[model samples]
Target: MRITELIDRTTLFDRILLVFLLFVTGASIVLIPLYLPHGGQIRIEVNNKLLYKLPINEDKTIPIGGLTVEIKAGKVRVADSDCPGKICVKQGWIDSGAIICLPNRVVITVEGTAAAPKGVDATT
Candidate 1:
């Protein structure tokens, strides 16, 4: 009887541990980006296609791989996704954000700041 009880507890412990690990991993993935500053202009390319170039002034949106991305306050995130899981969409807005859709061979990311590099004329 004691051996059976021990086995049952071990199984329960394993299940609990699995749940905890999953939660920790998921939280880390979401929270990690928030701490980093993502302010800047953005360049998105999908399958070598130039999707959009946006400045970090106000909210903006774009389409990549047939998906729509919404940006606000320097956060670049997928508002829609063609692929399953929708992890990219769930990732919310990211200021230096990136999402990969392997099926569509697409990648979206935020980059660049409002200020151009020294000696560089953006008007050119």
Candidate 2:
């Protein structure tokens, strides 16, 4: 049957149920972020092994396995790396998510609430 015909067959109870579900979904989208935790620490790993856990608020530069990691102003990035392609270095500063240098076997990830920066959804 046509979509309009099916919609016309819906009862008042069905309409009410649909509205309730839409309301619940909208409420969830709005309220959930307010209740969730945000911003914490960053974890650095090498060769699948934990290397360092540092607070995101602190600013420092760390050298591990020929990669230079810099954490400043609540963000962390690979300032420099010996690996080719330099993909990790090009990633720049990030308040959330990770910088993975596969050639160097390094992984840096932001832990806790995975909130992205304002106006940014997900970084490449």
Candidate 3:
């Protein structure tokens, strides 16, 4: 019937287990950024202008527009942002693909290795 009544039906162990799970999930969400691996070369752009091209091996921080991009130990991520949602910061580390902050017009992408195609060998 009532919401409280339904909760009351649950045993104390069940409630404790639910609370434990919630705590674990929330903690994991907050700590995930610390464990993500960094990727290749990084290209950062802000407000439609090419800003910085950095090697992934270096550890540095760059302030671009309203966001702070952090590169460390061969990984890259938006460490801080002035935008409303901080969506870019939540993107964590990216080895490939792009992390875009629409509100601040900041874009970060991991550049892949470029290898020229070899000429075709003799074919019978």
Candidate 4:
């Protein structure tokens, strides 16, 4: 593609689209992992009792109804939580590879021989 030709076709919409796409691409690189944690799992443990498990990852983006969570390499937190706490929801995206919600009885812990962060806790 010729630089001059590319410049010539540049319109407001084109510029906007280009900028938007760039922002999206850049953000996706970082955000993709959080929305879907790399644990290969969606486990539910009730009072130390194993409830259930599902295969998932950082790209899977476990959704808790109105809440959105981004799983990282260590712990998972509520990227968005439908529940009232928003506390778990607003923990600002973590991934010591483990995320758990005491209230909802929801637990997400990442485990795949992957690296874990120094200090990550889903409960906090």
User: What ranges in model 2 sit over 4 Å off?
Assistant: 1-38, 113-124
What overall lDDT goes with each candidate model? 0.72, 0.86, 0.81, 0.60
lDDT of 1 by residue, 1-117 (tens): 788787676776798898999999999889977764477777777778876777766787766656887777767777887787777777776666577766666677666566556
Ranking by TM-score: 2, 3, 1, 4
lDDT of 3 at 7: 88
Better of 1 and 4 by TM-score: 1
Least lDDT summed over 10 consecutive residues: which range in candidate 1?
A: 108-117
85-111, model 4: which lDDT tens digit per residue?
656665565443456666776665554
Candidate 1 matches the true fold with a TM-score of 0.56
| Two-way TM-score contest, 3 vs 4, winner | 3
Q: Is candidate 2 or candidate 4 better by TM-score?
A: 2
Candidate that beats the other on lDDT, 2 or 3, i.e. the better one = 2
TM agreement with the true structure for every prediction: 0.56, 0.60, 0.59, 0.37
In model 2, the clashing pairs are none
Estimate the Cα RMSD of every predicted model relative to the unseen true structure.
6.8, 12.4, 7.9, 12.6
Candidate 2's residue-wise lDDT over 1-124, tens digit each?
Answer: 9999999999999999999999999998788666544458888999999989888888999999889999898888899999989999999998766789999999988877444466746673
Deviation from native of the Cα of residue 95 in model 3, angstroms: 1.5
Choose the strongest candidate by TM-score.
Answer: 2
